[model samples]
Target: MKILVCISKTPDTTAKIAFADNNTKFAADGVQWIINPYDEWYALVRAIELKEADPSTVIHLVTVGGADCDPIIRKALALGGDEAIRVNADSHDSFYIALQIADIAKKGSYDLVFTGKETIDYNGSSVGGMVAELLEMPYVSLATKFTLIGSEAEIVREIEGGEETDKVALPLVVSCQKGMAEQRIPNMKGIMGARSKPLNVVEPVAADTLTSIASFDLPPAKASVKLVSPDTPEELVRLLHEEAKVI
Candidate 1:
Protein backbone atom coordinates (compact mmCIF):
# COMPACT_ATOMS: atom_id res chain seq x y z
CA MET A 1 0.00 0.00 0.00
CA LYS A 2 1.17 3.51 -0.81
CA ILE A 3 -0.01 6.08 1.74
CA LEU A 4 0.37 9.81 1.53
CA VAL A 5 0.15 11.74 4.79
CA CYS A 6 -0.27 15.50 4.73
CA ILE A 7 1.66 17.34 7.42
CA SER A 8 1.87 21.01 8.37
CA LYS A 9 4.11 23.23 10.47
CA THR A 10 2.49 25.23 13.23
CA PRO A 11 3.63 27.49 16.01
CA ASP A 12 4.45 25.65 19.22
CA THR A 13 1.54 25.64 21.65
CA THR A 14 3.53 27.62 24.20
CA ALA A 15 4.63 30.25 21.72
CA LYS A 16 3.25 33.71 22.26
CA ILE A 17 0.98 34.73 19.38
CA ALA A 18 1.15 38.24 18.04
CA PHE A 19 0.16 40.09 14.89
CA ALA A 20 2.05 42.47 12.63
CA ASP A 21 1.29 44.96 9.82
CA ASN A 22 -1.32 46.62 12.00
CA ASN A 23 -2.77 43.29 13.05
CA THR A 24 -3.15 42.14 9.48
CA LYS A 25 -0.42 39.48 9.51
CA PHE A 26 1.01 36.95 11.94
CA ALA A 27 4.29 37.89 13.61
CA ALA A 28 6.38 34.75 13.14
CA ASP A 29 9.64 36.11 14.46
CA GLY A 30 11.09 34.22 17.45
CA VAL A 31 8.31 31.62 17.32
CA GLN A 32 9.26 27.95 17.43
CA TRP A 33 7.43 25.78 14.91
CA ILE A 34 6.55 22.09 15.16
CA ILE A 35 4.36 19.56 13.41
CA ASN A 36 0.72 20.37 14.04
CA PRO A 37 -0.26 18.03 16.89
CA TYR A 38 -3.24 16.50 15.10
CA ASP A 39 -1.03 15.77 12.09
CA GLU A 40 1.80 14.27 14.10
CA TRP A 41 -0.11 12.49 16.87
CA TYR A 42 -3.00 11.12 14.85
CA ALA A 43 -2.71 11.23 11.05
CA LEU A 44 1.00 10.56 10.58
CA VAL A 45 1.21 8.13 13.49
CA ARG A 46 -1.69 6.11 12.09
CA ALA A 47 0.08 5.89 8.73
CA ILE A 48 3.25 4.72 10.48
CA GLU A 49 1.28 2.03 12.27
CA LEU A 50 -0.03 0.76 8.93
CA LYS A 51 3.50 0.63 7.56
CA GLU A 52 4.71 -1.23 10.65
CA ALA A 53 2.02 -3.88 10.19
CA ASP A 54 3.12 -4.42 6.58
CA PRO A 55 6.73 -3.69 5.89
CA SER A 56 6.00 -3.41 2.18
CA THR A 57 3.69 -0.45 2.84
CA VAL A 58 5.26 2.82 1.75
CA ILE A 59 4.55 6.02 3.69
CA HIS A 60 5.21 9.40 2.16
CA LEU A 61 4.89 12.78 3.90
CA VAL A 62 3.92 15.95 2.06
CA THR A 63 3.74 19.54 3.22
CA VAL A 64 2.83 22.85 1.55
CA GLY A 65 5.38 25.42 2.56
CA GLY A 66 8.68 27.06 1.67
CA ALA A 67 12.25 26.16 2.54
CA ASP A 68 11.78 27.10 6.18
CA CYS A 69 9.50 24.09 6.57
CA ASP A 70 12.41 21.66 5.96
CA PRO A 71 13.09 21.10 9.66
CA ILE A 72 9.46 20.19 10.31
CA ILE A 73 9.52 17.77 7.38
CA ARG A 74 12.75 16.19 8.68
CA LYS A 75 11.13 15.63 12.05
CA ALA A 76 8.21 13.88 10.36
CA LEU A 77 10.63 11.70 8.34
CA ALA A 78 12.28 10.67 11.61
CA LEU A 79 8.96 9.35 12.81
CA GLY A 80 9.01 6.76 9.94
CA GLY A 81 8.08 8.38 6.67
CA ASP A 82 9.88 6.74 3.76
CA GLU A 83 10.26 10.02 1.89
CA ALA A 84 9.07 13.63 1.91
CA ILE A 85 7.75 16.21 -0.57
CA ARG A 86 7.76 19.93 0.01
CA VAL A 87 5.69 22.24 -2.18
CA ASN A 88 7.77 25.30 -2.92
CA ALA A 89 5.17 27.86 -1.93
CA ASP A 90 3.41 29.42 1.03
CA SER A 91 -0.20 30.48 1.37
CA HIS A 92 -2.73 30.90 4.14
CA ASP A 93 -5.56 30.06 1.78
CA SER A 94 -6.89 26.56 2.40
CA PHE A 95 -7.85 25.93 -1.23
CA TYR A 96 -4.40 26.85 -2.47
CA ILE A 97 -2.78 24.43 -0.07
CA ALA A 98 -5.26 21.73 -0.92
CA LEU A 99 -4.62 22.20 -4.62
CA GLN A 100 -0.94 21.56 -4.15
CA ILE A 101 -1.60 18.40 -2.15
CA ALA A 102 -4.10 17.17 -4.71
CA ASP A 103 -1.57 17.71 -7.45
CA ILE A 104 1.02 15.65 -5.63
CA ALA A 105 -1.49 12.91 -4.83
CA LYS A 106 -2.43 12.72 -8.48
CA LYS A 107 1.14 12.50 -9.70
CA GLY A 108 2.12 9.94 -7.07
CA SER A 109 -1.02 7.80 -7.53
CA TYR A 110 -1.19 7.00 -3.82
CA ASP A 111 -3.69 4.39 -2.69
CA LEU A 112 -4.62 6.21 0.51
CA VAL A 113 -4.25 9.75 1.80
CA PHE A 114 -4.35 10.94 5.41
CA THR A 115 -4.57 14.40 6.90
CA GLY A 116 -5.14 15.82 10.34
CA LYS A 117 -8.60 17.11 11.21
CA GLU A 118 -7.26 20.65 11.11
CA THR A 119 -4.20 22.78 11.58
CA ILE A 120 -3.73 24.29 15.02
CA ASP A 121 -2.90 27.77 13.82
CA TYR A 122 -5.82 28.18 11.40
CA ASN A 123 -8.14 25.42 12.57
CA GLY A 124 -9.47 25.36 9.01
CA SER A 125 -10.80 21.83 8.57
CA SER A 126 -11.28 22.20 4.82
CA VAL A 127 -8.10 20.93 3.20
CA GLY A 128 -8.74 17.21 3.37
CA GLY A 129 -12.24 17.49 1.96
CA MET A 130 -11.08 19.77 -0.80
CA VAL A 131 -8.25 17.45 -1.65
CA ALA A 132 -10.64 14.53 -1.83
CA GLU A 133 -12.95 16.46 -4.07
CA LEU A 134 -10.12 17.44 -6.34
CA LEU A 135 -8.98 13.86 -6.54
CA GLU A 136 -12.55 12.56 -6.91
CA MET A 137 -12.13 10.19 -3.98
CA PRO A 138 -14.31 9.30 -1.01
CA TYR A 139 -13.59 11.39 2.07
CA VAL A 140 -14.00 10.42 5.71
CA SER A 141 -13.66 13.19 8.26
CA LEU A 142 -12.79 12.95 11.96
CA ALA A 143 -11.85 9.30 11.58
CA THR A 144 -10.95 7.70 14.91
CA LYS A 145 -10.48 4.12 13.82
CA PHE A 146 -9.34 2.83 10.45
CA THR A 147 -8.78 -0.82 9.58
CA LEU A 148 -7.88 -2.24 6.24
CA ILE A 149 -8.92 -5.65 4.88
CA GLY A 150 -7.64 -6.52 1.46
CA SER A 151 -8.69 -3.61 -0.77
CA GLU A 152 -11.49 -2.37 1.49
CA ALA A 153 -11.31 -0.14 4.57
CA GLU A 154 -13.50 -0.01 7.66
CA ILE A 155 -13.56 3.42 9.22
CA VAL A 156 -15.20 4.84 12.31
CA ARG A 157 -15.75 8.58 12.29
CA GLU A 158 -17.16 11.02 14.81
CA ILE A 159 -20.54 12.52 14.04
CA GLU A 160 -23.23 14.58 15.69
CA GLY A 161 -23.92 13.12 19.14
CA GLY A 162 -22.35 9.78 18.14
CA GLU A 163 -20.07 7.97 15.68
CA GLU A 164 -20.62 6.37 12.32
CA THR A 165 -18.98 3.41 10.62
CA ASP A 166 -18.10 3.48 6.93
CA LYS A 167 -16.84 0.85 4.56
CA VAL A 168 -14.95 2.41 1.70
CA ALA A 169 -12.73 1.07 -0.99
CA LEU A 170 -9.04 1.85 -1.48
CA PRO A 171 -7.81 5.22 -2.87
CA LEU A 172 -9.83 7.25 -0.36
CA VAL A 173 -8.94 10.15 1.91
CA VAL A 174 -9.32 10.37 5.68
CA SER A 175 -8.96 13.27 8.07
CA CYS A 176 -7.81 11.83 11.37
CA GLN A 177 -8.25 12.96 14.96
CA LYS A 178 -7.76 11.51 18.45
CA GLY A 179 -8.20 7.73 18.91
CA MET A 180 -6.57 7.14 15.54
CA ALA A 181 -3.14 6.45 17.00
CA GLU A 182 -0.88 7.35 19.87
CA GLN A 183 1.99 9.80 19.44
CA ARG A 184 5.47 8.51 18.69
CA ILE A 185 8.72 10.20 19.63
CA PRO A 186 11.68 9.91 17.28
CA ASN A 187 14.53 7.85 18.70
CA MET A 188 18.24 8.31 18.02
CA LYS A 189 18.25 5.68 15.31
CA GLY A 190 15.27 7.13 13.48
CA ILE A 191 16.71 10.61 13.73
CA MET A 192 20.02 9.43 12.31
CA GLY A 193 18.25 7.60 9.50
CA ALA A 194 16.11 10.63 8.65
CA ARG A 195 19.22 12.63 7.79
CA SER A 196 19.80 10.29 4.84
CA LYS A 197 16.18 10.14 3.65
CA PRO A 198 15.23 11.92 0.45
CA LEU A 199 13.31 15.22 0.62
CA ASN A 200 12.16 16.39 -2.78
CA VAL A 201 11.05 20.00 -3.30
CA VAL A 202 8.62 20.59 -6.12
CA GLU A 203 7.16 23.83 -7.44
CA PRO A 204 3.46 24.29 -6.99
CA VAL A 205 1.13 24.09 -9.96
CA ALA A 206 -1.07 26.93 -11.17
CA ALA A 207 -3.47 27.80 -8.38
CA ASP A 208 -5.24 30.91 -7.22
CA THR A 209 -5.89 31.82 -3.61
CA LEU A 210 -9.57 32.37 -2.98
CA THR A 211 -9.34 34.15 0.33
CA SER A 212 -7.10 36.57 2.19
CA ILE A 213 -6.92 37.60 5.79
CA ALA A 214 -8.21 41.13 6.26
CA SER A 215 -7.09 41.52 9.85
CA PHE A 216 -6.76 39.77 13.19
CA ASP A 217 -8.16 40.78 16.53
CA LEU A 218 -7.53 39.32 19.97
CA PRO A 219 -10.37 38.30 22.23
CA PRO A 220 -11.44 40.65 24.97
CA ALA A 221 -9.68 40.37 28.33
CA LYS A 222 -11.42 38.46 31.08
CA ALA A 223 -13.60 40.47 33.44
CA SER A 224 -12.81 40.52 37.14
CA VAL A 225 -14.88 38.21 39.38
CA LYS A 226 -17.56 39.70 41.58
CA LEU A 227 -18.13 38.05 44.94
CA VAL A 228 -21.57 37.60 46.51
CA SER A 229 -22.12 36.71 50.15
CA PRO A 230 -23.69 33.32 50.77
CA ASP A 231 -26.25 34.83 53.09
CA THR A 232 -27.46 37.22 50.37
CA PRO A 233 -29.30 34.78 48.16
CA GLU A 234 -31.31 37.60 46.60
CA GLU A 235 -28.13 39.41 45.59
CA LEU A 236 -26.72 36.24 44.01
CA VAL A 237 -29.91 35.70 42.06
CA ARG A 238 -29.91 39.33 40.96
CA LEU A 239 -26.27 39.07 39.88
CA LEU A 240 -26.92 35.94 37.89
CA HIS A 241 -30.01 37.41 36.21
CA GLU A 242 -28.69 40.90 35.50
CA GLU A 243 -24.87 40.81 35.46
CA ALA A 244 -23.72 37.30 34.60
CA LYS A 245 -26.94 36.65 32.61
CA VAL A 246 -27.02 32.95 33.37
CA ILE A 247 -30.70 32.91 34.31
Candidate 2:
Protein backbone atom coordinates (compact mmCIF):
# COMPACT_ATOMS: atom_id res chain seq x y z
CA MET A 1 0.00 0.00 0.00
CA LYS A 2 1.19 3.49 -0.78
CA ILE A 3 0.04 6.59 1.11
CA LEU A 4 0.52 10.29 0.60
CA VAL A 5 0.26 12.55 3.64
CA CYS A 6 -0.02 16.29 3.23
CA ILE A 7 1.71 18.46 5.83
CA SER A 8 2.26 22.19 6.26
CA LYS A 9 4.29 24.60 8.33
CA THR A 10 2.57 26.88 10.79
CA PRO A 11 3.57 29.43 13.36
CA ASP A 12 4.16 28.04 16.84
CA THR A 13 1.13 28.52 19.04
CA THR A 14 2.98 30.85 21.37
CA ALA A 15 4.37 33.01 18.60
CA LYS A 16 3.12 36.56 18.45
CA ILE A 17 0.88 37.16 15.44
CA ALA A 18 0.90 40.44 13.61
CA PHE A 19 0.17 41.89 10.19
CA ALA A 20 2.28 43.97 7.84
CA ASP A 21 2.15 45.61 4.40
CA ASN A 22 -0.95 47.58 5.39
CA ASN A 23 -2.43 44.55 7.12
CA THR A 24 -2.22 42.56 3.90
CA LYS A 25 0.60 40.19 4.90
CA PHE A 26 1.68 38.23 7.96
CA ALA A 27 4.67 39.47 9.93
CA ALA A 28 7.23 36.69 10.12
CA ASP A 29 10.09 38.40 11.88
CA GLY A 30 11.24 36.56 15.02
CA VAL A 31 8.43 34.04 14.63
CA GLN A 32 9.07 30.34 15.08
CA TRP A 33 7.58 27.81 12.72
CA ILE A 34 6.63 24.19 13.34
CA ILE A 35 4.68 21.40 11.74
CA ASN A 36 0.96 22.09 11.90
CA PRO A 37 -0.25 20.17 14.97
CA TYR A 38 -3.22 18.41 13.38
CA ASP A 39 -1.02 17.18 10.52
CA GLU A 40 1.69 15.90 12.81
CA TRP A 41 -0.42 14.51 15.60
CA TYR A 42 -3.30 12.90 13.69
CA ALA A 43 -2.85 12.64 9.91
CA LEU A 44 0.86 11.78 9.68
CA VAL A 45 0.89 9.70 12.84
CA ARG A 46 -2.03 7.61 11.58
CA ALA A 47 -0.13 6.97 8.34
CA ILE A 48 2.94 5.96 10.33
CA GLU A 49 0.82 3.57 12.35
CA LEU A 50 -0.44 1.98 9.19
CA LYS A 51 3.11 1.65 7.87
CA GLU A 52 4.20 0.04 11.11
CA ALA A 53 1.44 -2.53 10.82
CA ASP A 54 2.68 -3.38 7.34
CA PRO A 55 6.34 -2.90 6.61
CA SER A 56 5.79 -2.99 2.87
CA THR A 57 3.55 0.05 3.10
CA VAL A 58 5.26 3.14 1.70
CA ILE A 59 4.52 6.50 3.28
CA HIS A 60 5.36 9.72 1.51
CA LEU A 61 5.01 13.24 2.90
CA VAL A 62 4.28 16.23 0.70
CA THR A 63 4.16 19.96 1.40
CA VAL A 64 3.58 22.99 -0.79
CA GLY A 65 5.86 25.81 0.17
CA GLY A 66 9.33 27.25 -0.35
CA ALA A 67 12.68 25.96 0.96
CA ASP A 68 12.09 27.46 4.37
CA CYS A 69 9.60 24.65 5.04
CA ASP A 70 12.41 22.06 5.01
CA PRO A 71 12.95 22.03 8.77
CA ILE A 72 9.27 21.33 9.38
CA ILE A 73 9.34 18.58 6.76
CA ARG A 74 12.45 17.07 8.29
CA LYS A 75 10.75 16.96 11.66
CA ALA A 76 7.84 15.09 10.07
CA LEU A 77 10.31 12.67 8.50
CA ALA A 78 11.81 12.11 11.93
CA LEU A 79 8.39 10.88 13.00
CA GLY A 80 8.56 8.08 10.36
CA GLY A 81 7.73 8.89 6.78
CA ASP A 82 9.65 6.90 4.19
CA GLU A 83 10.33 9.94 2.00
CA ALA A 84 9.33 13.56 1.53
CA ILE A 85 8.41 15.80 -1.40
CA ARG A 86 8.42 19.57 -1.35
CA VAL A 87 6.56 21.58 -3.94
CA ASN A 88 8.50 24.77 -4.55
CA ALA A 89 5.78 27.35 -4.35
CA ASP A 90 4.65 29.98 -1.87
CA SER A 91 0.98 30.85 -1.76
CA HIS A 92 -1.68 31.21 0.92
CA ASP A 93 -4.48 30.24 -1.43
CA SER A 94 -5.90 26.82 -0.52
CA PHE A 95 -6.70 25.90 -4.11
CA TYR A 96 -3.19 26.62 -5.29
CA ILE A 97 -1.66 24.35 -2.67
CA ALA A 98 -4.26 21.66 -3.28
CA LEU A 99 -3.49 21.76 -7.00
CA GLN A 100 0.19 21.12 -6.35
CA ILE A 101 -0.57 18.21 -4.02
CA ALA A 102 -3.08 16.72 -6.44
CA ASP A 103 -0.50 16.88 -9.21
CA ILE A 104 1.98 14.95 -7.11
CA ALA A 105 -0.61 12.38 -6.03
CA LYS A 106 -1.47 11.71 -9.67
CA LYS A 107 2.14 11.14 -10.66
CA GLY A 108 2.83 8.91 -7.66
CA SER A 109 -0.28 6.76 -8.04
CA TYR A 110 -0.80 6.59 -4.32
CA ASP A 111 -3.55 4.37 -2.95
CA LEU A 112 -4.53 6.70 -0.13
CA VAL A 113 -4.18 10.36 0.76
CA PHE A 114 -4.30 11.94 4.21
CA THR A 115 -4.47 15.51 5.42
CA GLY A 116 -5.20 17.39 8.65
CA LYS A 117 -8.69 18.68 9.21
CA GLU A 118 -7.41 22.23 9.04
CA THR A 119 -4.34 24.39 9.44
CA ILE A 120 -3.93 26.11 12.77
CA ASP A 121 -2.93 29.51 11.41
CA TYR A 122 -5.65 29.90 8.82
CA ASN A 123 -8.17 27.40 10.18
CA GLY A 124 -9.16 26.75 6.58
CA SER A 125 -10.57 23.24 6.20
CA SER A 126 -10.76 23.37 2.40
CA VAL A 127 -7.56 21.83 1.06
CA GLY A 128 -8.38 18.16 1.55
CA GLY A 129 -11.74 18.44 -0.18
CA MET A 130 -10.21 20.44 -3.00
CA VAL A 131 -7.55 17.82 -3.59
CA ALA A 132 -10.10 15.05 -3.60
CA GLU A 133 -12.23 16.97 -6.08
CA LEU A 134 -9.24 17.66 -8.31
CA LEU A 135 -8.25 14.00 -8.23
CA GLU A 136 -11.82 12.80 -8.62
CA MET A 137 -11.55 10.55 -5.58
CA PRO A 138 -13.87 9.83 -2.65
CA TYR A 139 -13.30 12.16 0.28
CA VAL A 140 -14.05 11.75 4.01
CA SER A 141 -13.41 14.67 6.28
CA LEU A 142 -13.01 14.99 10.06
CA ALA A 143 -12.10 11.37 10.35
CA THR A 144 -11.43 10.35 13.93
CA LYS A 145 -10.81 6.67 13.27
CA PHE A 146 -9.42 4.89 10.21
CA THR A 147 -8.82 1.21 9.66
CA LEU A 148 -7.49 -0.50 6.57
CA ILE A 149 -8.86 -3.89 5.54
CA GLY A 150 -7.35 -5.25 2.37
CA SER A 151 -8.12 -2.78 -0.43
CA GLU A 152 -10.91 -1.06 1.51
CA ALA A 153 -10.78 1.51 4.29
CA GLU A 154 -13.24 1.81 7.16
CA ILE A 155 -13.51 5.28 8.61
CA VAL A 156 -15.44 6.95 11.43
CA ARG A 157 -15.92 10.69 11.15
CA GLU A 158 -17.47 13.32 13.39
CA ILE A 159 -20.76 14.86 12.36
CA GLU A 160 -23.04 17.58 13.67
CA GLY A 161 -24.63 15.59 16.50
CA GLY A 162 -22.85 12.26 16.34
CA GLU A 163 -20.40 10.18 14.25
CA GLU A 164 -20.78 8.64 10.82
CA THR A 165 -19.11 5.49 9.51
CA ASP A 166 -17.94 5.04 5.97
CA LYS A 167 -16.24 2.33 3.97
CA VAL A 168 -14.43 3.55 0.89
CA ALA A 169 -12.27 1.76 -1.63
CA LEU A 170 -8.63 2.44 -2.29
CA PRO A 171 -7.39 5.70 -3.80
CA LEU A 172 -9.44 7.83 -1.46
CA VAL A 173 -8.74 10.97 0.60
CA VAL A 174 -9.32 11.55 4.32
CA SER A 175 -8.96 14.61 6.51
CA CYS A 176 -8.00 13.46 9.99
CA GLN A 177 -8.94 14.93 13.35
CA LYS A 178 -8.03 14.52 17.06
CA GLY A 179 -8.93 10.89 17.76
CA MET A 180 -7.21 9.50 14.68
CA ALA A 181 -3.86 8.80 16.36
CA GLU A 182 -1.67 9.72 19.27
CA GLN A 183 1.18 12.14 18.78
CA ARG A 184 4.67 10.70 18.34
CA ILE A 185 7.91 12.26 19.48
CA PRO A 186 11.03 11.79 17.41
CA ASN A 187 13.65 9.69 19.09
CA MET A 188 17.42 9.91 18.61
CA LYS A 189 17.47 7.05 16.10
CA GLY A 190 14.55 8.44 14.12
CA ILE A 191 16.13 11.88 14.09
CA MET A 192 19.45 10.46 12.88
CA GLY A 193 17.75 8.42 10.18
CA ALA A 194 15.74 11.41 9.01
CA ARG A 195 18.92 13.26 8.12
CA SER A 196 19.62 10.65 5.45
CA LYS A 197 16.07 10.36 4.17
CA PRO A 198 15.46 11.59 0.64
CA LEU A 199 13.67 14.95 0.33
CA ASN A 200 12.79 15.55 -3.31
CA VAL A 201 11.91 19.10 -4.35
CA VAL A 202 9.65 19.60 -7.32
CA GLU A 203 8.28 22.63 -9.13
CA PRO A 204 4.58 23.33 -8.87
CA VAL A 205 2.30 22.86 -11.85
CA ALA A 206 0.53 25.76 -13.54
CA ALA A 207 -2.50 26.86 -11.55
CA ASP A 208 -4.16 30.21 -11.01
CA THR A 209 -4.71 31.41 -7.44
CA LEU A 210 -8.35 32.16 -6.84
CA THR A 211 -8.08 33.93 -3.53
CA SER A 212 -6.08 36.76 -1.97
CA ILE A 213 -5.89 38.30 1.44
CA ALA A 214 -7.46 41.72 1.64
CA SER A 215 -6.65 42.73 5.19
CA PHE A 216 -6.32 41.33 8.71
CA ASP A 217 -7.81 42.78 11.81
CA LEU A 218 -7.18 41.66 15.36
CA PRO A 219 -10.17 40.72 17.48
CA PRO A 220 -11.38 43.28 19.94
CA ALA A 221 -10.09 43.14 23.47
CA LYS A 222 -12.27 41.26 25.95
CA ALA A 223 -14.32 43.17 28.46
CA SER A 224 -13.55 42.96 32.17
CA VAL A 225 -15.71 40.74 34.39
CA LYS A 226 -18.23 42.31 36.75
CA LEU A 227 -18.73 40.81 40.19
CA VAL A 228 -22.17 40.43 41.75
CA SER A 229 -22.67 40.06 45.51
CA PRO A 230 -24.53 36.91 46.55
CA ASP A 231 -26.55 38.85 49.09
CA THR A 232 -27.91 41.31 46.51
CA PRO A 233 -30.01 39.08 44.20
CA GLU A 234 -32.10 42.05 43.03
CA GLU A 235 -28.97 43.97 42.00
CA LEU A 236 -27.71 40.92 40.10
CA VAL A 237 -31.05 40.60 38.31
CA ARG A 238 -30.96 44.30 37.44
CA LEU A 239 -27.40 44.01 36.15
CA LEU A 240 -28.24 40.99 34.04
CA HIS A 241 -31.32 42.67 32.59
CA GLU A 242 -29.71 46.08 31.96
CA GLU A 243 -25.98 45.44 31.16
CA ALA A 244 -25.60 41.75 30.35
CA LYS A 245 -28.97 41.71 28.54
CA VAL A 246 -29.20 37.94 28.41
CA ILE A 247 -32.39 37.71 30.41
What Cα-based lDDT does every candidate model obtain?
Answer: 0.96, 0.95
Candidate 2 lDDT, 1-247, residue by residue in tens: 9999999999999999999999888999999999999999999999999998999999999999999999999999999999999999999999999999999999999999999999999999999999999999999999999999999999999999999999999889999999999988999999999999999999999999999888999998888878778898899889889987999
lDDT of 1 by residue, 143-180 (tens): 99999989999999999999999999999999999999
TM-score of every model? 0.95, 0.95
Per-model C-alpha RMSD: 1.8, 1.6
Candidate 2 residue 101 Cα shift, in angstroms, is 0.3
lDDT value, residue 69 of candidate 2? 99
Clashes of each: 0, 0
Model 2 lDDT, full chain set: 0.95
Residue 117 alpha-carbon offset, candidate 1, angstroms: 0.1
User: Ten consecutive residues with minimal summed lDDT in candidate 1?
Assistant: 221-230
Error of 1 at 75 (Å): 0.6
Off by over 4 Å in 1: 227-238
